[model samples]
Structure formats: C-alpha cells, structure tokens
Target: MAEIVLANVSKSYGAVPVIEDVSLAIGSGEFVVFLGPSGSGKSTLLRMIAGLETIDSGTLTIGGQRCEQLPPGQRGVAMVFQNYAIYPHMTVRENMAFGLRNINLPQAEIASRVADAARILEIGALLDRRPAELSGGQRQRVAIGRAIVKEPRAFLFDEPLSNLDAALRVRTRVELAELHQRLRSTMIYVTHDQTEAMTLADRIVILNERRIEQIGTPLEVYMRPVSRFVASFVGSPAMNFLEVDVSRRGAERLVTLPSGAALPVPIDLPNDGRYELGVRPENLRVVPSGGDLVGEAVIIERLGDRTLIHVRLADGRSLTAQDSGRSNVAPGDRVALGIDRAEMHLFDASGRAWHPAQAQAVRATETA
Candidate 1:
C-alpha cells in the first residue's frame, strides 16, 4: 500500500514555525491536494512528505515504512516542481532516462521505461525534442513523465501547472486527473488555486497561517464550512458577511439584519447578542423589495449566464448577489437582495460556524 501517515509533524526554520503539530493519514492511491494562500506552509508540508525538507518534530511513514530519517533518494516518492525542471540540452527521452541511468539500470530496461512513460504521458512524439522546442505544457508532461518512470510509491506535485496559461492549466489539470486514474498511485499536490484544488483533489487540505484549517472533499467544505476562514476562502466571489443581532422570539430564533428585517434561523443558538451572517453570492438573488436585506446597487457585472450585483447597504456594508444574465439592474440603482435561508451560516465571536442541520442534529441528540 502507498498510504502515508504523519504523526504530530512540526517543522520550523530556527524560531519561526512552518507546519506545527500537523497529523494526517492519506489512504493508498488517494489524490490529496494541499491548498492555501501563499506562505501558508502548504508547499512546505508537501516537501516534508517528499523528504526534501526536514521536520523538527514528528514521525513520517510512507508506504508502511518510516521515512523521516531517510534521505530523499531513499524515500519511495518522486516530486515534480513548479518549474518544468527539464534540462535545456537534453531531449525529453534523455531527461526522463537520466535518473534511471544514475542508478545504473541496463540500457534496455531504461529505454523500456522511457517508452512506457512517454506513451502514458502522450509525449512519445516529442521524445527527441529539447525543452526549448517544446511548449510549456509539453515540457510539463516531460517532467511528469520523468517522475512516472521512477514508478515511485507516491507522486508529489508542487504547483506544476502554475507556469502554464489559463487554457493550458485547465487542459493539464484534466490530464493529471486522467493520469491518476490510470496509475492509481498516491498523489499529493500543492497549489494556492482553489479551482485546481476543487477540480483535481479527492480531498483538499486547506492550510492557514502555517497550519491546516480544514480537510474535506470540495463540496463538503463549500456547503458546510467549519469556520469563517474556510467559508470566506473556499468560494469564488466569496461569502458575504454582516454583523447581526440575535433574539429568541418564543420558540423561534431570529436574526435582525441591518436592513431591519428579522429572519428565523433553524439552529437554536445560545443567548446570542451578536453573530456574523455568512451567505454566498449564489445564495442571494435580486429582489424588488421586502426581502432579507435591501441595498443600493453599486456595481453590476454581466457575466454571460449570470450577472453579479454588488450592493451597498445604508449601514455601508456591501454584499454581492446573483441575478439573471439579462438583468436590467444598473449601477446606483436601488436593488434588494433575497437570501437562501437554508444555505445561510452563522459564525460566533470566535469564527466557529454553526450550520443549522448540524446544530439541529446535535440538539436532538442532546435531548435524546
């Protein structure tokens, strides 16, 4: 099995810590992505698993073998970096065969491995071409082919597609997914792009401030974020936030928005004075009036299929709501927004999320 396990792994450069007390268990053949903003230690964590970086404290086991004390070459893992890392002078075939030659593999065996990798990466036609003659995507495929020839227990990719243009990035991302399906090998990828994480990963590990903030499938984190950081970071256009007051009206829990509209929340919270209301842009629609909140449209983005209306409330808070593509709303127009109550999330003072369904289930269990 190619499963990897890390126990309380902590790493630091002198006094400043990078990854601290991080533990994870990656199942065999799993495609896991480390996702976060820059300097969030996602790449560092991947490097640790690849044996490129040392951990100050913890144990790392890869494919059932302890590897923290081993050197990178000894670890049964291959890494592909952000840059293609292919040599300018060497042809694609030579670049892929270099490592095997270093280990003194027989010439015939090396040629067979290179040919198989080229077939797998669909770069056989470019086998004799140097890096300079290849496109950015081609060079990246060569880099992956080099790792594939190693046939390592696991593959680690560090933003390998970041160098490509938008279109190439999308194409290469699909190729990577197909590669994983064919190989069924454990793969760990690192990237700051949430789209890549959402599309490529079987599970996403979101790192924040040198530690993991959340880990789950893309939809899990998108639909039921555990905290404000996740709810704000995972979604495009982002989740809107507004400070709201809470009160218990008989048996119903109500939240008062800045627009003076009172809405009922399913989850029964504590004697709440204040909480943050989080609603995604897609969860809101342009309404005429008497909605959850009313605001003035400050900006309108016509994005083909859907339009985004940025509204500014009287209290100076801004929110973005989605409208029809042919929306007649214009900038500075008075626009009201209706929210999806089931998709609403509440964040307490500590930024912890209280999902209605989860909280309702817990409440039932508590009284059971």
Candidate 2:
C-alpha cells in the first residue's frame, strides 16, 4: 500500500479547464472518495491519478515516487472501471490472469495469483465461467479480481457499482468495504453518489467546478459543513436555507424572516448585513403552538420508518423537516417548529460558516 499525494495538480483541454490547482494527500491504507456531480472534475481527477489523463501542471507522487511522467502500468496502481471491462470470451480466471501473462510472469505464479484473488472475491467457483455467463455483479467482481491479482500499491475505482441494480449495488458496496478491510490497501474512489461516499470513505473530498470545496470525515462534513454548498449537498433531503436579515435585538443579534417574524439567534453571528439560516430536516422538530417558527405543511412523504414534511412558511420560503413515520399531520395543517439551537448553522453572505459564538447567540435568542 502507498500514500498518494497531488500538489497543485491541474488538468485542462486547451483553454477549458477540468481540474484547477487541486492538492490533496491520501494516506497509506486510507479509503478516500472523490464526490461531486457530473462535470465537477471528480472522474477527471481520478483519471489524472491513474495516468489515464495528462496533468497540465503540478506533480503527482505515489509511495514517494513522482508518477506524473510514468506510464500507468509502472505507477504501481490498478484501476477498476465503471464498465467492468471484462473480455466476453474469456473465463474469469483467464481474465484475471491476462495482465500477468502479458508481462511474461511464470505460469505457476500467474495461476497462484489468480486463484488467490478469486478466493478473496468469493468467485472461485465461477472461475471457469465466461463473462457472458456470469451475472452483472459477478462480472464486476471479476473485474476487481483482475485488479487484485496485480497486487498494486493502490486501487482506483471509478463508480464501480453504478451499473448494478439497487439490491446488487448495496451488496457490492458491502463487499467492497469488506475487501478494503481485508486488503488494507490505499483506495481512491470517485462517485457522484453521496451514499456511496459516506459509507465507504474514511475521508470524503467534495469537489465542485474544478476545485476542492471541503475534505473531511463523513460525519464532520454532514454535521459541520464549512460552506452552504456542502450543507445542501451532503445530506439526504438536504438542509433548509432561508434568507434572513441580521438585526440586533437589544444586545443580541436576531434573524428576521421575510414574513417579519424574528427567530432567536443561537450563534454570535457577525452583524453582517446579510446571512442565511441553515437548519437540517432532522434538526427541526414539530412542536405545539408558540414555537419559534411556524409553517403550513404543504406536502408529506411517509417512508416506512420516517416522514418528511415539506412546509411552506408565511413568507413563501419552504423547508423540509423529518418526523416520526406515525405523524398524523396532513397537508394544509399549520404547525409550529422548533430548531435545535445546538444544531443550527449560520452562514455569512459569502456562504461560509460564522463563529460558534455567533451561532450560539442566534440560538439563544430564538430559544429565549
């Protein structure tokens, strides 16, 4: 296993830049995921690491060796593509052994490596079957086994489970997590799916238009997003953002909603002229009358275990809140809402988080 480092690395096609001055360190034996929407440079960045795309500037080092100039085969990295890329006519064993054979390894050694990989992937029984005969998930496993047999210093996965059905995707996700635990190799995965990034990564790198937005553990990014973009992108149902004017009520700062209602400030926010109040659905509670915020329930989504309420406030801004699945509230019901002061987040005009004291003061005012 090896640590991968990128220092001011960038990629561009002519004048159109795909990745811009991206620098990051992936530690040895770490599972790091690159997460973003399509055209967000996530896959482009992954390909740059695999040497499938040329870097316009900067350096890439793997295991302490500069690899920007090295060919992919010599980088000591193996990549599993989204398409599986298995040979239709080749058996699983043959597909796994093909790379080793091309390098003129001894027959016995190639066979041993292939066998070991198949056993680890739990596909030994299917070794003699051709790609066409195997299921989609099985074929994908063969593709991974092919990479495993190479024994590279690191593994790169480009949306490896995107092609599978929902049930199969979940199963393969678990299998990949198990594989990482057993191999303990440095892995870099790229995906547009937040669920995949949250579940598999030791750290998630949030990428936006050619730049890194935030890098942190799953819970860190979810609970304490540094930017409004991350706050809205990282969670299911996303966080609710309401534009508010920051005004002082006595000595404390209060956020005035568009509807002319004021909520207590929990955090000490800069008396900045403008700000946004961010509250996650899970942090907002349906309360009896006299709560800090009031909204009319516009839509209700009832999942088996939980319900999501899309509420339209008096000012026309909408917010979603999570509730117990047994909640009996129907559309058109006016409900009072309480936001957990500790869970409230405040963003400045530039969308960055304000100081904790500012946040706490806002919460305190709202609760008061």
Candidate 3:
C-alpha cells in the first residue's frame, strides 16, 4: 500500500484555475473520499493523482516517491471509472487478463491473478460471460476486478456506483466496503453523492470552488462542519439555517429566535452581530403550543419511519423538522418547533462554525 500526498498542488486552464494550493496526505491503507458538487474539482484532483491531469505547481508523491511527472502506467495505481470501462466484446476473464498481458507477465501468472481477482469479487461464475451478458453491477465488478488483477498499490474509484440502480448501488457499495476491509489498500474515491461520501470514507475531503472546505470523518463533517457551506452541503434534506441573536450570560449562551423566544445553547457566543443557527432536520422537534418558535407547516414528507415537516415561521423563514412517523401533523397546521440546543451549530457571518465544546476542542487542535 502507498501513502499519497499532495503538497500545495494546483491546476489551471490559462488564467482560470481549477484547483488551488490544495495539500492533503492520504495515509497508506486508508479510504479517503473526495466529495463535492459538479465543477468542484474533485474529479480533476483525482485525475491529477492518476497522472491524467498535470500538476501545475507543488508536488504529488506516492509511496514516498515524487510522481507528479510520472506516466499513469508507472504510478502503481489502478482506476475504476464511472462508466465501468470494460471491453464489450471480451469475456469477463479476457477483459481482466487484457491489462496483465501488456506488462509481459507469464500467461500462468496472468491467469492466477485473474482467477484470484474473480474469487475476491465473487464473479467466478460470470467469467465466461461477455460484458453484454452481465448486469450493470456485474460489469462494474468486472471493471473493479480488472483493477485488482494489476495488484496496484492503491485504487481510484470515480463515482463507480453512480451508474447502478438504487438497489444495486446499495449492494455494490456494501461489497466495496468489504473489499476495502479485505484488501486494506489505499483508496481515493471521488463522488458528489453525500451518502457515498458519508458511508464509504474513512475521511472525507470536501471541496468547494478551487479549494478544500474541510477534511473529517462522516460524523465529524455532519455534526461539526467548519463552514456554513460544509454544514449545508453534507447533509440530506440539508440543514436548516435561521438568523439568530446570541447573548452570553455568565458561561451560558442564549440564542433568541426572531419570534422572541430564547433558548439556552451549549455553544459559546461569538462577538456581536447576528449568527446563523444550523439545526439538522433530525435534531429539530415539533411541539404543540408554546414551543420556542411558532410556524405553520407548509410541507410534510413522510418516509416510513420518519416525517419531515417544513414550517414557515411568522417572519417568513422556513425550517424543516423531523418528527415521529406516526405524528399526524399536516400542511397548513400550526406547529411549534424546538431546537435541540445540544446538537445545534452556530455559524458566524464568515460561515465558520462554532460547535459543541467537544468538537470545538478538536477543531482547535486541528488548527493548532
């Protein structure tokens, strides 16, 4: 396995820069995911590591060797694409063995490698089938198997599951997690899907514009986002942001909603000026009358075990709360919403967040 490192790396098209001064160290045998929206340079960054995109400045090192100028074939990395780039005319076994032949390995060695990869991927039964005869998930497994046959130091997956159906995606995702655990190979996966980033990554690198926003674990990014953009972009149904006034009384911080209701929060207050309160849907609860904030439910989304209530406050701000699945709240109904102070996030005018004491300490350490 190899530890991949990028030091102040940058890329640009003429005067338009795509990636700017990004430095990251992906540990050996670690699974790190590059997560961002379209045009966020995640795929570009992955390609840079693969030698498909040239690094304009700084360094790219793999296994302690500088590889910014190395050819893709010599980088000791295998990449799986979103399209599952396998040969349609070749059988699964042929497709996997094709890459090995070019390396001048003995035929028996190539067969052994292909057989081992097929066993690992549990696709030995499909080895005789052509790409045309395989399901999308099976074809993707074949693509992955081809990479495995190379026995590269690391694996690069670019939205590998994006092409699968929902159920197949779920299954393939589980298989991938198992593969990582089994091989313990260094892997860098790029995707815009938050679910993939959240579930698959040992650490996630969130990119925005031409820079990285944050790097942390799934729960860390979800609960302690360093910026407003990180908090809003990493969660499903997104986080609800409300303009709030904060005041300090002794050691406690009191957050006052626009409706004039005050709730004591565990976070420390920043200096004067309004802060945005970020609460995930799961952390917001609906009360009857006399809740902290009063609003009218404008939309209700029921998803089996949970119900999402989108409420419009008196001041015209909207908030979504996750309620009980059996709760009978409907649109047009008056609902009182309470914020989970313990789970809330406070974002300053600059979009930087102040999390709970535990998270703040960790954030401070990272900065230090």
Candidate 4:
C-alpha cells in the first residue's frame, strides 16, 4: 500500500481544459472516492492517476516517488474498468495469470497467486470456466482477480459496478467493502453514483466543472456543505431553497422569506445582502395548521417508510418536506410546514454557505 498525491495537476483536450490546478493527498491504505455528475472530469482525473491519460501540468507521486513521467506499466497501479475486460477466449485461471507470464515469475508462484486470489474472491470453483460461461458478476470478479494477482501498490476503479443488476450491485458493493478491509490496499474509485461513494469511501472528493468542489467525509459534505452546489447535490431528496432578505437586529440575524415569515436563524449575516434559505426535506415538518410556512400540498410521494410532500407556497415558490410514513395527507390538501430555524442554511449570492456557530446567540426581537 502507498499514499498517492496530486500536486496542482491539470489536463486539457487541445484548447478545452478538462481539469484545472487540483491538489490532493490520499493517505496510504485509504479508500478514496471521486464523485460527480457526468462530464465532471472525475473519470479523466482517475485516468491521469493510473497513467492512462497524460497530466498536462503538475506532478503525481505514489509511494513517495514522483511518477507523473512514468509509463503505465512502470507505475505500480492496477485498474478495473467499467466493463469487466476479461478475455472471452481464456479460462478464468488463465486470464488472471496472463499478466505474470512476462514478469519472469516461476510457474508455481503464478499458480499460487492465482489460487489465492480466486479463493479470496470465492471464485475458486469457476477457475476453469471461460468468460462466456460465467455470469456478469463472476466476470467482474475475475477482472478484479487479475488485478489482485499483480499485487500493485494501488488499485483504481472507474465505475466498476455500473454494469451489474441492482441487486448484484448491492451485493458486490458489500463484497468490495469487505475486500478493502481484508487487503487494506490504497484505492481510488470514480463514480457518478452518490450511493456508491457514500457507502465505499473513507473520504469523498466532489468535483464539478473540472474543479474540486468539496472534499470531506460523506456526513460532513451532507450536513455542512461549504457551497450551495454541494448542499444541493449530496442529499437524496435535494434540499429546498427560497430567496430571502437578511437583516441584523442587535447581535442576532433575521431572515424574511418571500412568504412574509420572519425566521431567526442561528447564523451571522451581513446587515444587507442577497441571501437564500436552505433546509433539508427531513428537517421541514408539515403541520395541520398555523405552520410558519403556509403551502398547499401539490404532490405527495409515498415511499412506504417515509413520505415526501412537495408543497407550493403562497408566493408560488415550492419546497419539499419529509413526513412520517403513516401521513394521510394527499395532494391538493392545504397544509402548513414548519422548519427548525437552527437547521437552516444561508447562502450568499455567490453560492457561498454561511454556517451557524456552535453556541447559539440571543434570538432576534420580533419584527413586523
């Protein structure tokens, strides 16, 4: 296992730059994930680390060695692609052992490594089967087995589970987590799936428009996003946003929503600035009457365990709130929504977040 570091790395396609100056340090034996939407340069950045793509500028270091100039074969890394690139003509055993043939290793050593990898992956019984005779999940295991036989310093994955069925994907995801614990190898995974990143990563690097947005643990990014983009992207049912005006009353901050509700939040704000209020669906509550946020339930999604109510405010703005699974409210019903002022998020016009302090200040006096 080895630590990987990218120092001000950059890449481009002719005149169109894909990755800007980005620096990150992945500790040894860590399971890091690169997560983003399509065209977010996540895959391109992973390729640069694997030496599959050229780094237009900056340096990449692995195991304390500068390796940006090294060829892929010379860099100690193994890559697993989206499609399980196993040779259809070769048996599972042969496919896993093919890479060792040119390395001048003894035949017995190669067989031992192949046997060990198959055993660890629970594919020992299918070693003699060709790729055509195996299932998709099995084929992916063989691909991973081939990488394991190389015993590289680090492993890189590019959406390795995208091709599996949903059920199989979940199972494989658990197996991968177990495998990481067993091997404790350094791994960098790239995916557009937030679920995969949340479940598999020690740290998540959120990328947007070829730049890193926020790098944090899943909970950190979810709970205290540094920017408006992250707050909107990390959660399942995205957070709700509403334009609001900010004012300072003594030492407290007051926010006036378009719905004419004045909410005293636990965050410091400039006396005058364009700000918006953000609240997660789970934090917003639907009340029978006299809620701070008055709205009509335009859409109700019953998810069995919980219900999501899309409420259209009087001012024509909309927000969603998660309610109990047993909620009997239906669409077209008039309801009141209440929010925890302490849980609110304030974002400036520039999409920057203003976090509340740990110690709560005195509440602002009532405003007309």
lDDT of 1 at 125: 95
Question: Compared with the true structure, what per-residue lDDT tens digits does model 2 show for residues 1-368?
Answer: 99999999999999899999999999999999999888999999999999999988999999999999998999999999999999998988899999999999999999999989988999999999999899999999999999999999999999999999999999999999999999999999999899999999999999988999999999988888889989989999899888878888788777786667676675675464678888889888788677767889999999979889999988788889878889988999998887777787888878797645555567878899
lDDT of 3 at 105: 94
Model 3 residue 34 CA deviation in Å:
0.5
Which of the two candidates, 2 or 3, achieves a greater TM-score against the reference? 3
Tens-digit lDDT string for candidate 3 (336-366): 8877778988899889888787556766877
Worst 10 residues of 2 by lDDT: 353-362
lDDT of 4 at 67: 94
**RMSD vs true structure, all candidates:** 1.1, 3.6, 2.2, 3.8
Each candidate structure's count of clashing pairs: 0, 21, 0, 0
Q: Write the per-residue lDDT of candidate 1 for residues 1-368, one digit (tens) a residue.
A: 39999999999998899898999999999999999999899999999998889988999999899999999999999999999888999999999999999999999999999999999999999999999999999999999999999989999999999899999999999999999999999999999898999999999999999888999999998998999999999989999999999998899999898878899988767667899999999999998776888888998899999999999999888899999999999898888789898888999999889888887788889999
Error of 1 at 74 (Å): 1.2
TM-score of each: 0.98, 0.94, 0.96, 0.95
Greater TM-score among 1 and 3 belongs to 1
| Alpha carbon lDDT of each predicted model | 0.92, 0.90, 0.92, 0.91
What residue pairs are clashing in model 3? none
